[model samples]
Target: MSVTQADIDSAATTLSTVIRRTPMIASRVLSERIGCEVWLKCENLQRTGSFKPRGAYNRISRLSDEERARGVVAASAGNHAQGVAWSASSLGIASRVYMPRGAALPKIAATKAYGAEVILEGSTVDEALVSARAFADETGAVLIHPFDHPHIVAGQATVGLEILEQMPDVDAIVVPLGGGGLLAGIAAAVKARRPDVTVVGVQAAQAAAWPQSLADGHPVAAASMNTMADGIAVARPGDVPFAHISELVDSVVTVSEESLSTALLLMLERAKLIVEPAGAAAVAAVTAGAVDLSGNVCVVVSGGNIDPLLLSHVTTHGLTAAGRFLTVTATVSDRPGGLIALLELLRDLGASVVDVVHSRVADDLYLDEVQVTVSVETRGPEHQRELRRSLSDAGFLRD
Candidate 1:
C-alpha cells in the first residue's frame, strides 16, 4: 500500500493527542556555518525522546479491536521499543519488544518502564528482528515493524506536515536515514505539496545503505554496519522507503563517525541541546558541507535517546577532536616536588588539568624517575600546542 499526503494529514490529526508537536528552532550557529537560514526540527524532545511514538501510536491506534486483543510485537535497538511500549500501554494492549542483548541499558529499562515485556536477544536489530518475528508467529501477535509498513510510513509523514506548516518558506529538508520510513514519509509529504523543495537524507558513513541502494536502483545490503548512531544503522533499506526515496529524495550523503560525535557535542555546547549521534547526522552533513546550502533548510534532529555511557565517550572523543582536551605523558624526577613542578609549569601555561596519574613503577622509569600522565583542558588546538611547547621546553620528556 502506497502512502499519500492525505494519509499523512490523517495521521497528523490522529496523532495530535498522542504526540508532541516538537518545536522548530532557528539556529544562528548552524545557519552561519551553512550560509543559509537553518531551522532545527527538534524531534529529539518529542514524546518518548524521539519521533517513533508518532508512528507507533498511529499504527496501533488503527488496529482492529480483535487484533489489539491479540497484542503486538516489535524489535528495536532502542527508540522504537519505547515508542511501541508506551503506545501499547496507553491503548490497553499487551506489548512485547525484542531488543539486542547489547542494546543500551537505559533504553531496555525505559521500554520495560513503559509496561512492555522486554526480551533481549541477538547482537543487532536485524538479528533481534528474527526473534521478534518468531515470537509474533508463535504468539499470533501483530508485528509492528520499525520502518517498513504503509501505516508506519504514513504515520511518520506527519512530521513532514508539521515541518511544512512550521516553515512555509522551507526550500530544503534534511533528515537522518535509517530504514527510510522518516525520510520517505517526509519526502512524499513535502514533495507532494512542494515539488521544487530539495529533500536530502544523511546516513552514518560506517553504516550507509541508501546511497548504494539508490545507485543500484534497488535496496541493497550494506557492506558493513558499525556506528555510534545505532538508531540509523540498518544494514539494508526498506523497499517501501526506497520507492519514495528514489522518486522524491534529491540527494543522500554520509558523515564520518568523527563528524557525528562533533555534531553531537556542538549541539550540546553551542545549542544547549542533548542530541544522540543519529539525531545529529543531518547537522553533521550540513557542517561537513555535504548538503547544498542554497536556501532555507530545516534539519530533523531525529532522536535524543542516547545512553549516558555512550554520551560520555562521544563527548570525550569530540573534545579530543576539537583539541579542547589534551593528554601528555611526561617523565620527571621522582623528587619531593617533581609532580608539583610539572603542575606549576602547566599552571603557568594556563592549561587546566582535569585528571592526572603519577607512576614510578613503569619498566622504563628509573628508581628516581616518575612518569606523570596529565589530561588537561585547553582553549583549543592553539592552546594545546602552546602547552605542549612549554612542557617540552621545560625539559620534560614527553612520550
Candidate 2:
C-alpha cells in the first residue's frame, strides 16, 4: 500500500477527466507577511468544491465491474461524501454515504444532489464511520474509506504532482491535516521526487491531534474547542497516514480559529477567492507563525463550501481582528448637537458607522449625557486610532 510517483502520475491521468487541475496561485500580500513566495493551491475550486474528489475518483475508478455492480458506501462529515457520491455517480455505481448529524447543510445538500443516498447518522464522523462499515457489510457494498486506503492516498498525491509541475522550485508545501490522505499523498510524491522540498501539515488548534499525538508517541485528541474548520476536526489521524507523516512530514502546525477565520476572510476579500476554514488552515498557520516560511512556500486551499450565514460571521470576525472594524462606547451630551458633532468627527476621519447602540439611562452616562455604543469600519488600526483621536479632539469622551 505504499504510495509512489507512479501512483501520483496514474492518479493525475485518471482524474484529468473527473477532477480539475486546481490552480497554483501566488499571493504577494501573503508572501510579504510570511517572508516567503506564497502560492495558494486552489483545490477549493475543484470538483465538489474540495480535493476529496481526487482520492474518491482514484479509488472508485479502480473498482472491478463486479464491485461497481455491488456499489459503494462511505462515511464523512461532508467533503468525503460529496467526493464519493460524485465519483460513484460518474461510474454509474449506486452510492450510499453516511454523515454525522451536525455536518454542514451545504455539504449534505451537495452530496445528495450528486446522486447518492444520503444517510444522517451519529454525532461524530467516527460514529458515522462505524455505521457505514456495518451498512457496507450488510449490503455487500465496497466501503470506500475517506483516508485510510492506499488508493485514496495515491489519488490525493495527484495534488502534489500538480504542485511540483506548477512550481518546480517550490521550497515548501503546506497542507491541512485531517486523517492525512492529502498529506500522505503529497508527501509520497514530493519526497519520492524532490526530498529537499519541505512538506508541512497544518491543523486547527482546536483539533490538533497529530502534533499532540506525535508528542505523546500515540494518538491523543486535544481538548474540544469551537473552530470554523470542521473539515480538519478529526479526533485522531489515521495510523497508516501517521506512519508516512512521522517519516516524511517535515513538521505539523496548528492555527487558532481566529487565525483561520481571518485567513479565510482575507482570501475572500483581498485575494478575491472563497476558502472554507479547513482549506484556509495552511494560510492560518502561516499567519500564526507556524512555518519557518521565508522562501517559496505553497499552501493548499483544500475547499470552499462555506455556508452563507457562517460566511457573514467570518467576515465580521476577520474585520474585527484586523482592526478594520472597531467597537467602542462614547458619551455625549443629551443634546441634538452633541450626536451630530460625533458624526462629524467620524466623517472627518473617513470612518463609516456600521452599528449603534444608544442608552440614556445607563449609570455610565451622566444625566445630561447619552451613551452611544458605536461600531465603525476604518482602514486599519492606524485609521481607527486616528478616528479615535478625532473624537478626543472634538471634545467627545469615549467610554
Candidate 3:
C-alpha cells in the first residue's frame, strides 16, 4: 500500500496526544564549521528516547477489540523495543518484547520497566524476530513489527511532518536507516511536501543494508551485528520502506564505527546532547564526508538511549579524534626511584598517568636496567610531546 500524505496527517493526529513534538535545535558552531545552517532534529529527546513511539502508538491504537484483548508483541535490537513497550503500557495493553540476548543492558532494563514482558531470545535481531513471530502466532497476539506495515510507515512519516512544521525551509535532511521505516516515512512526507528538498540516508558501514538493497532492487542480508549503531543494525530492509526508498531517498551513505564514535562524542561535548551511536549516524556521515551539506542541513539525532559504559568509550575516542586526549606507552627503569622519577616528570609536564606496569626482568635490559611500561594520558598531542621531552632529558634510557 502506498503511504499517502493523508496517512501522515492521520498519524500526526493519532499520536499527537502521546508522542512529543521533539525540538528542532540550531547550532551556530556546527553552522560555522560546516559552512551551512546546521539544525539538529532532536528525536533523541522524543518519547521512549526515539521516534518509534509515534508509529507504535498509532498502530496499536488502531487495533481491533479482539487484537487489543490478545495484546501485542514485537522484536527489536533496542530503541523500538522501548517504544513498543512504552506505547503498549500507556494504553493499558499487555506487550511481550523479544530482544536479542546481546541487546544493551540499559535497553532491556528500560523495556522491562515499561511493564512489558521481556524475552531474550537470540544473539542477533533476526533470530529474536523469528521467535517473536512464532510466539505471536502461538499466543494469538497482534504482532507489531519494528519497521514493516502500512500503519507503522505512516506513523514514522509523522517525523517528517514535525520537521516541516518546525523548519519549513529545511534544505537537506540526513536520516539514519536500519529497518528503513524511519527513512521511508521521512522520505514519503518530505518528497510529497517539498520534492525539491534533499533527503539522504545514513548507514553504518558494518551494517549497510540499504545501499545493497537499492542496488539489488530488493531487500537483502545486511552486515552482521558488529556495528555500534545497534539501533539500525537491521539485516534486511522492510518491504514497506523499500517502496519509498526507491523513489524518494536521494542518496545512501555509509559511515565507519570510528566516525560514529566521533559523532557521538562531539554531540555530547559540543551540542550538550547525548545521542546513541545509531542515532548519531547522520552526523557521523556529515563528519566523515559521506554527505555533502554545502547548503542548510538538518541532521536527525534519532535516539539518546546510549549505554553509559559505551558513552564513556565514545567520549574518550572522540577526545582522541579531536587531539584532546593522547595515550602513549613508554619504558622506564623498573626500580622504585626510577619509576617515581618518570612519574614526577609526567606530572611536571601536566600529563596524567592512567596505568602503569612494571617488569622486574626483561629480555633486553642491562644488569640493573629492568623495564617498566607506563600508559600515560596527556591533555593533547602537544602535552604528549612535552612529556616525552621531559622523560628523555631526565637521563631515562630509550628502549
Candidate 4:
C-alpha cells in the first residue's frame, strides 16, 4: 500500500512526543565543496542514534491491544534493532530481536539494554530475518519489518515534514537508501508539499540493488553484498517502498567504498560529527560528485551507531583513499644503519613515519639485503608520488 502526505502528517503527530526533532545544521565545508548551500539533517543525533525510532514508535503505537499483548519481533544488523527494542520498551511491550552473528557488539549490547531478548543468528541481516520470521510465525508475535510497511514508511516520512519546516527553500533532498523506506517516505512527503524540490537516493556501490531494480521495474536481488556500510547492505528493496520510490524519487546514485569512508572521515573531522558508513552514503555522493546537486540541498546523516574498531579502520582507509597516507616496501642494505638511513631519507622528504617493519629473511631477498616496509603520512597525491620517486632514486625500491 502507498503512503500519503496525510499519513505522514498523522505520523508526525504520533511521533510529536515520542521522537526527537533532529536538527538541520548548515554545512559550510560541504557547501563550498559541492558549490551549493548544503544542510545536514542530523538524524545521527536522534534517539537510538538514528531516525528508526520515529518509524518504530509510530508503528508500535498503532498496534491493537491484542497484537501488543503478543509482543513484537524484528531483525536488523544494528540501528533498527535498537529502535524497535527502545520503542517497544517505552510502550510497555515485550520485544525480541534477531541479529546477524557478526553484528557489532555495541549494537547488540544496546539492543539488550533496551529490554529486548536479543538472538544472534546467521551471518547477514537477510539470514537473521529468516529466523525472525519463523519465530514470529510460531510464537504469534507481531513482526516489525525494517522498511516494508505503510506505517513504517509514513513514520519515516515525518523526517521529510520536519525538513520542509526547517528548510522551506530547500531545492533538493538526498537520502541514504537501503530498503528505500527513508528515501521513499521522505520523497512522498516532500514531493506532495513541494513538488518543485528534487529528492535523490544514495547507496553503497558494493551493495546497491535499487538501480537495477528500478531498471527492471521490480525488486531484484543483488548478486553479492559486501561493504563496510553494513547498515545499508540490503540485498533487495522492499516492495512497499519501491512503489513510492519509483514514483517520487528523482534519481538514485551509488558511491564507492572509498567515498563512503572519506565522507565518514570528513564528517568526523570537519563537521565534528560521528556517522556510520551507511549514514555517510548521502554525503559521499555529494563529496564524490556522484550526484549533480545544487541550490539549498539537504543531505540526511541517517545514523551514527558505528563500532569504535570499525571507525578506526575506516578512518585509516579514508586517509589512504584521500592520498594522505602511503605504504611502501623497499630493499635496503642489511647493515646496522640501514633502517636508520631509510628513516632519515623519509624524514628529509617530509613524510611522517607512522609504522615500520624490517626483516632480512625473505625468499627473494639477498643475504645482504633487508626488506623494509614503511607506512607514512603524506600531504597529498603529489607528495606521495614525490616520495616514491625519491625512494626509487635512492635504489631502495624493488621491481
Candidate 5:
C-alpha cells in the first residue's frame, strides 16, 4: 500500500526523538549559479551518516515481540546496513546484515561496530539480498527491505515533513533516487501538505532505472548499472516505491557521472561538505541543468559515508571533467636543456605541474625526440585551452 499524510505524521512522531532534524543551510554559491535561492538539507550529517536510519529504525521498531525476538536481516551496499545495525542495537535486538563483498571497508567496520553480525556476500546489493532472504527464511528473522516497504516509505516521509517545516516557502525539493523510497516518500508527504511545491528525483545516468521504468509504466530493470554513486546504483526500482513515485513525483531526471563528481567536488570546496556521490545527485542535477528549477529549491544531501580513497579519485576526476586538470603528451628534443625549457614555459604560462613522466623510447618516438607526459593544473576551461594553444605554438604538440 501507499504511504499517506497520516502515516507520515505517525512516522514523524515515532522518529521525533530517534532521528536528527538535520539543518537546512542556504548556499550562496549555488543560489547565484542557479538564479534562485537554494537550500541544502544536510541529511549527510544524520546519525550513521545518512537518512537510512529513519527508515530502518522506523521499520524495525514496529516489529512484534516475536519478530523482535527473531531479530532482523537486511542487505545493503553500506549505508542501509549501518542503519539497520545501529537501529537494531539501539533497541537491543540482534541484527544480521549481508553486504556486497565490494562494499567499503569503513562501512563494513561501522556496521560491525553497531553490533550486527556482518556477512560479506556477492558483488552487489541485489546478490546480497538473495542471501539475506534465505537467512530470514531459515532463522525466522524479519527481512527489512531497504526501500520497498510501507513502513520504510512512511519513515522516509519524515524528511519531507521536516523540510516543509523548515522551509515553508520552498518551491521545490530535489531528491536522489535509487530504489525510490526517499523520493516517493517525500513526494507523497509534500504533495499532501503543499501540492504546489514541486518534487523532483535525480538519478545517476549510468545506473538510472526510473526513466525507462516510468516510460514502460512499471518497474523495469536497467540495462546496466555502473557509477561511482554506489548508494543509488539499484538495478531496478522497488514495486512499492514505483507505485508511489508514478503517482506523486513531479519529474525524474538523470545526471552524468562527471556531473556527480563535479557536484561532490563543489560541495567539498565551496560548502566544506563531504557528501557521497549519491548524496550529491540532486546538486549534480541542479548544476548540470537537468531540471528547470526556480524559486526556493531544496536539494537533499542524503549521505556522507564515502571511502577516503574513492573521494580522492572522484575529486581528481571532477577536476579533469571541469577542465581544471589536464594531462598531455608532448615531443621534446632529446637534450638536457629541452625538458628544462618545457617546464619553464609551463611555469611562465601560469600552469602548475602536478607530475611529469619523461620517456626516451617508445613505439612512436623518434631517435632525436623524447616523449614527456605531463599532468598540469589549470584555472578552468579557458586556461586549459590557453595552455594547449601555447604548447602547440611552441611546436611541442604534434598536430
Candidate 6:
C-alpha cells in the first residue's frame, strides 16, 4: 500500500511517546563550509542511537494481539537490529534478530542486551535475511522487513514532520540513503507538504544501490557492498521505499570513503557531534560538493552507533586526508648521532614526531646508510610542505 501524509501523521502520533524528539539545530560551521544556512537534524541522538526505533516501534506496536503473541523476526547489519530489539522489549514481545556475522561487536552486544535473541548468521545483511526469513517461517513469527513495510516508512516519516516543525524556513533536506526508508519517509513528508523544498539523498560510493536502482526504475542489487559506513551498506533498496524515492527525492549522490571519514571527523571536531560514517553521509555530500547547498539546508545525522575501533581508524584516515598527519622516510648515515641530527632538525622544523622506526640492514639500504621512518603531526598541508622543504634543505634524502 502507498504511504500517505495521513499515515505519516498517524505514525508521528503513535511514536510521540515511544521515541525521542531528536534535535534540529543550526550549524554555523557547516553553513560556512557548505555555503548555506546549514542545520543538523540530529537523529544520531534518538532512542537506540538512530532513527530505526521510530519505525520499529511504530510497526511493532500496531501488531494485533495474535501477532504480538506470535512475536517478530528481523535481519540487519546493526542499527535496525537494535531498534527491533528495543521495540520488542518495550512491548513485551519476543524478538529474534539475525545479524551479519561481521556486524559491529558493539551492535551485537547491544541487541542482545536489549533482550533479543541475536544470531550471527551470514557475512552480509542480505545473507542474514535468509536466516531471518527461515526463523520467521519456522517459529510462525511475523517478519519485520527493515525498510519494506508501509508502517515502517510511515513511522520513519516522523523525522520529516519534526524537521518542518523545527525549521519552517528549510529549503532543502539531505538524508542518508540505505535501503531508502529514511530518505523515502522524509521525501514523502516534505514533498507532500512543500513540493518546492528539495529532497536530496546521499550514499557511500562503495555500497551505493539507489543510483543504479533509480536508473533501472527498480531496486537493483549492488554487486558488492564495502565501506566504513557499514550501516548504509545495503545490497538493494526496498521496493516500498524505492517507490516513494522515485516519486519524491530530487537527487541521489554518492560520497567516497575519504569524504565519509572527513565528514565524521568534521562533525566530531567542529560540531562536537560523534557521528557514525553512515550518519555523516549528508555532511559528506555537502563537503564533497556532491550536492547543491545553495539554500537553507538540513542535513540529517542519521545515527551515532559507530564502533570505537572503526572510529579510531576513521580518525586517523581523516587526519591524513586533512594533511594534519604525515609519515616520511629518510635515508641517513648509520652513525649514533645521525638519528639525533635528524630528530633535531624535525624539532627545529616544529614537527612533533609521534612514532619512529629505524631499519639498518635492508636491501634498499647502503652499508653506511639507514632508513628512518617517522610519523609526525603537522598544522596542515602547508606546514607539511614546509617540513618537506626543510628536510630537503637539510640534505636528508627523502624516500
lDDT of 1 by residue, 1-399 (tens): 688777888888899887899999999999998789999999999988999998898899999999999999999999999999999999999999999999999999999999999999999999999999998889889999999988899988989989999999999999999999999999999999999999999999999998889999999999999999999999999988999999899999999998999899999999889999999999999888987768899999999999989999999988888788899999898888988999999998888999999887787877889899999999999998888888898878655
Q: Each candidate's TM vs. the true structure?
A: 0.94, 0.91, 0.92, 0.99, 0.99, 0.97
Model 6, position 273, has a per-residue lDDT of 95
Compose the digit string of candidate 4's lDDT tens values, residues 334-364: 9889888899999999999999998878899
In model 4, the runs with Cα more than 4 Å from the true position are: none
List candidate 3 segments past 4 Å from native.
Answer: 360-373, 379-399
- Please give the lDDT score at residue 276 for candidate 6: 95
Give one digit per residue, the lDDT tens place, for model 6 in 1-399: 689888998999999887999998888888888779999999999988999999999999999999999999999988999999999999999999999899999999999999899999989999999999998889889999999999999999999999999999999999998998999999999889899999999999999988999999999999988899988999989989999999899999999998999999999999999999999999999988998768889999999999999999999999988888999888888987999999999998899999999888668777899989899999899999999988888767655
Worst 10 residues of 6 by lDDT: 390-399
Candidate numbers sorted by lDDT from highest down: 4, 5, 1, 6, 2, 3
Q: List runs of model 6 lying over 4 Å from the truth.
A: none
List candidate 1 segments past 4 Å from native. Answer: 361-368, 397-399
Candidate 5 wrongly placed segments (more than 4 Å): none
Q: What is the lDDT of residue 332 in candidate 3?
A: 61
State candidate 1's TM-score: 0.94
Q: Estimate the overall C-alpha local distance difference test score of candidate 1.
A: 0.92
Q: What range of 10 consecutive residues in model 3 has the weakest lDDT sum?
A: 327-336
Report the lDDT tens digits of candidate 5 across residue range 1-399. 777778888899999998999999999989999899999999999999999999999999999999999999999999999999999999999999999999999999999999999999999999999999999999899999999999999999999999999999999999999999999899989999899999999999999899999999999999999999999999989998999999989999999999999999999999999999999999999999999999999999999999999999999999999999999999999978999988999999999999999998788888899999999999999999999999999989988
Q: What is residue 207's positional error in candidate 1, in angstroms? A: 1.6
Model 1: lDDT of residue 234: 99
Residues 113-151, model 2: lDDT tens digits: 999999999988888999999998898999999998888
**Cα displacement (Å) at residue 230, model 4:** 0.7
Summarize candidate 3's per-residue lDDT along 139-225 as a digit string, tens digits. 999999998988999999989988888899899999998989999999999999899889999999999888888999988887565
